[model samples]
Target: MQSTPSYLWSTEDLLGQGATASVYKARNKKSGELVAVKVFNNASYLRPQEVQMREFEMLRKLNHKNIVKLFAVEETGSSKQKVLVMEYCSSGSLLNVLEEPANAFGLAESEFLIVLQCVVAGMNHLRENGVVHRDIKPGNIMRLVGEDGRSIYKLTDFGAARELEDDEKFVSVYGTEEYLHPDVYERAVLRKPQQKAFGVTVDLWSIGVTFYHAATGSLPFVPFGGPRRNKEIMYKITTEKPPGAIAGIQRQENGSIEWSYELPITCRLSAGLKDQLIPILANILEVDQEKCWGFDQFFAGTNDILHRIVVDVFSLQQASSHRIYIHSYNTTTMFLDAVFKQTNIVPHHQEYFFEGHLYELDPNLQARHFCRTTESSPLTLLSTSEQPEDVVGVQYRDPALDFPKLVPRVDVVADCSAAKSAVGAAHQTLRVGQALRRGRELLARGLHWVIGNLRTECSRILEQRRGAHSVLACLQLTEGRTHVLCEAVPAGGRAPAGLDVLRTRLRRVDEELSQCSRSIFDFQGALDGILAELAKDGQQVHEDKSIQQIECCLEKMQVIYKQFKRARTCLRLGYNEEQIHKLDKLNLGSLARRVLSIFQNGCVQQYQEALALHSSRMRKVCEIKKHLKRLSNRISSCSVEMMECQDCLQGALDRLLQTENWDLAAAPPAPSPVPLSQARQEMVLGMQELLEQMRSVTCDLQLNNSIIERLGGAAPTPSV
Candidate 1:
């Protein structure tokens, strides 16, 4: 047993021990959160400090839900042992889940798919970041039970992880022999001190082996013999046929047993699942790296048979649209429910008319069955009382040329004008009222939509800032560890002066990064306030209020963007400034150059990447602002037209009141006021055009929201 750090960590129990370090279940004193602390021994041959630092750097750069999170790093004891505090997975490792007695028959197909997807996704993320987890194995993968009780598999144990150079070749042999590909095994068996270089494909092979173990509840090739076991395992991996058939046993009267490959357990997989999985396993286990199935191929193949369907919903009344992904087995009602949840449409008032027929959507009927009887056209939803023309008014028609002549012929011009004015006045008043109501609704919805998008973007920015903070903390730890090592050197042979300079520079960089973190917190607070205000029930929607909200969002986005720019400038100048003043004048040494390069790659490069991401998001915000401005202007124009129409109607009504004895039956037929009708028609068309624009902006906001959510946020909870 080892003593724990009294202030930061309180060790509850020893978890496990490895070759280089011992893991303990600990509680973080400040946050009071449970975490797994891996404390390395100072004298281990594994060079534990170096390995821990490298793992920390890699984990800081990679952010994925399916990857284990590195919380903090600390140097403990007089020996300067490194301890890594990481996310605690209460469900243990995947190996434990597979070998448990309850799962002796192997995981269900769905569970297996979940594990496979998560691992592959995590691996893909690593590859994208130019990293290779050279030691991907079942024991390196942990199972975490989420708050909802669903198991999430995360890739961990990055001690063997490496960043690959453009033309890099890995000669070091790492990982468990059982999970190694044939190519790796061949290299490991070479007599020379060095091995041939390998790439990320080795990880795919390990994943395949892990998948096999999970599917069969056994290793693909059993180890036999003592000292010669490695050779035997290599031979089996290279020359033996892949497992697909299971062995059956028969008993004779004399108690003799006969074994045969039979149906009792064929590769320990059901026929349906095997058909889908065997091909993937074969491709992953390919001996040549080039022939292995890449992430995109596996993703495409899996999605094709995954039974998911994308449903697009268009709201005729509100002129809003939403796209949702659902299972093919979901009923029509379920699909409609999902659409309504997103669009905020009341289910009772929802009468979805599609393809010229009234779809009486039964709650129990599957969508697939309903589509079978309908026309093959893509589904377009409409309110039962709404016409196509009502939702999307004729775009090309000139109102002046298209107005109908509604009055009969009249000899007296005065009589005709009076009758025409009466009818026109009534119709104009009705149209003006409708336009005013719809305009207000559109403004409200658009404001709300933009607010939602801003919330998501703000959340993503906060997540990115958190990652940056983690990296900064790790860099500080690296600085501390280096200082400790320097102090250990003999007093007669003082440590290099450049090391002191590096530590000072690191401290300055960390202080600047702390400022950046605070700025992000402020941005988040502002966004939260905006979201809360927007969410208030029955809040009045007016042009001024909407404009004020949009302006506020724009201002905050610009401020955050500027902050990111300033941080990038600080990172670049901070390193270069120090180098110019100190390192340039000193006698150049290899260690000093290495330390500076590490700082550049570790801190400056990461800041650059973050800056680029922020700039990209800022461009999106600019686009949103442009659309918001247009929406505000459109509402203002609509308001002016509505007021004018009301005034005209009021004047006509007053004139009609003066002619109290006007004849009803004997009134001469009136020639319709074509110009007035045309004006009204044009106004209606303008309102429709504004509605279409609102819909387009809403859709754009939704898309950006989804992108931000996927970038850093957790998967959205399915709507009930």
Candidate 2:
């Protein structure tokens, strides 16, 4: 027996235990730094000295951000056995994350990227060090949310790892059965006689399995009675499948095994991502070992993806905000240009500001500087000329706003078979009732998002209307000044007389109108612009796929609940199309919208054309035309420049009659939209109705829960 050595760290909570050692959460006595201490038992040390020291030697030489940092080798204060102190990962293992109900369908897109980077880097590090991590499963990868709040994954547990050059082969095999390459598994576990030696590429097979699990939350190959009972069949499915199959085989209900390489619909990764990822998995999971990717080729493929991932910037607010994707390579100036595409604010006029700091107009600063991940801060278009552009110009919509993420459904179908007994039925009902209650809560969250979006849109429109009115009044003032200035100028810049004064007046009016166009477009074009903006504002709201999906689930919930027993409150939050449309509702007044509509009915296009003419012909433009307009002039001067520039006013008046012609015939008036106030009132009333229903459902759930407890169904049911 080995004597225990003095400890420099406290060991209170056991993190995990294995055949070789028990790992405990420990803190450094001096530094107070958290770490994991792996204490080797007498049985572990009883093994050959070389085998026991292999892990320690290998881990000591490894140094990479993706590989766990080794702090010190010590001894247990009590047992006097060797203990390895390593970096503590508070977030636990990737396997633990996969076990989460939300992650059962696999990690979300952003999360999967983190895992990809971490694993690839770790594996590459192992390869560079001429070391092979024979076991590369999720269980061996530890995760901790970094100071930046990103999941920092690190490879740990070098028990099965050994030094091996790329071309060199090791005779012994070491890995979890499911993740092991077919060649190794056949010899090591199945005990089949085989001459082939395991090489570093064995790790590639494990990586493919790990990625598959991370992507789909399940193993790639399976057979009837699971791998343990049907190990040979599982091997056949993996080995006998055609090259580049990337197949996932599983047993069906009727004793049939199905194989497919396609990512399931339940997978959270998008089709575009799958396009990039599936090929990589296929190359790695090749049954023919020779065709598999080496670390270099693998790095190239992953790097391509990492470099192209756009920064998904949000709007003014996070909870209720629009998500806009901008290329990661875009500079702050370029970032504003991307925002301009969505917001219609020209780049020069837009200011990129967030994080409570004005990012220097550093043209060299890339958007990726702020985006360590695919998602970044909400994008706001603040006009340099006007009062900071408020939420009026900020489009606020998130996919989360439309979709309600629910806990994974309990396995009700299996439980239904056991429903013959009172306890069974009561247990099933309890499960269904609780699931429905959770569903209602998530649905309530969806409703809250809807209400928030509606209220925000309303506030934005009101602010927009007020800003528009203020700008229009200013336009009318600027228009009067332009006319007076035009009449006073003799040569209209053809002669030097009054040219400076004329230029100053032109610049001021140009500045005023430019400011207006940046915020809400010209006063003449206000209605169409508002309507256009409205369409943009409600763009995400119209995607009702989430609502449809929710409805389908609700129906399924009803069906499942019906088989066991009926609970009226289950799946009855009164979710309907009418209530769903409230997500698109706005409380901007009907009178306000109507008045704005009347102003933009016809002359807006011609006014812009005339303004454009003055801009084009005279080098006057809001860019101060983004630079001029609404000049109400009676220019009496006979100078050629005066007549040409006078077109700004005369051309506008002449084009006024042409807009009604935009409609070819006398069209019947469309029905007036329901008053916005009435619409808002209806939205509020619907919200109240939903709240009341949820409260009622909650009460019923409580009653149902009490009944369930009386029937001795208080014990937790096993999750699916």
Q: Please report the candidate that would top lDDT against the real structure.
A: 2
Consecutive 10-residue window with the lowest summed lDDT within model 2 = 629-638
lDDT of 2 by residue, 83-167 (tens): 8889899988999988653465678778998999899888888888999999899989999998899999999999878899988
Q: Clash totals for all models, in order? A: 0, 17
Q: Worst lDDT window (10 residues) for model 1? A: 393-402
- Model 2 shows how many backbone clashes? 17
Which digits, one per residue and each the tens of the lDDT, describe model 1 over residues 419-471?
23222222222222232333334323333444455555555555544443444
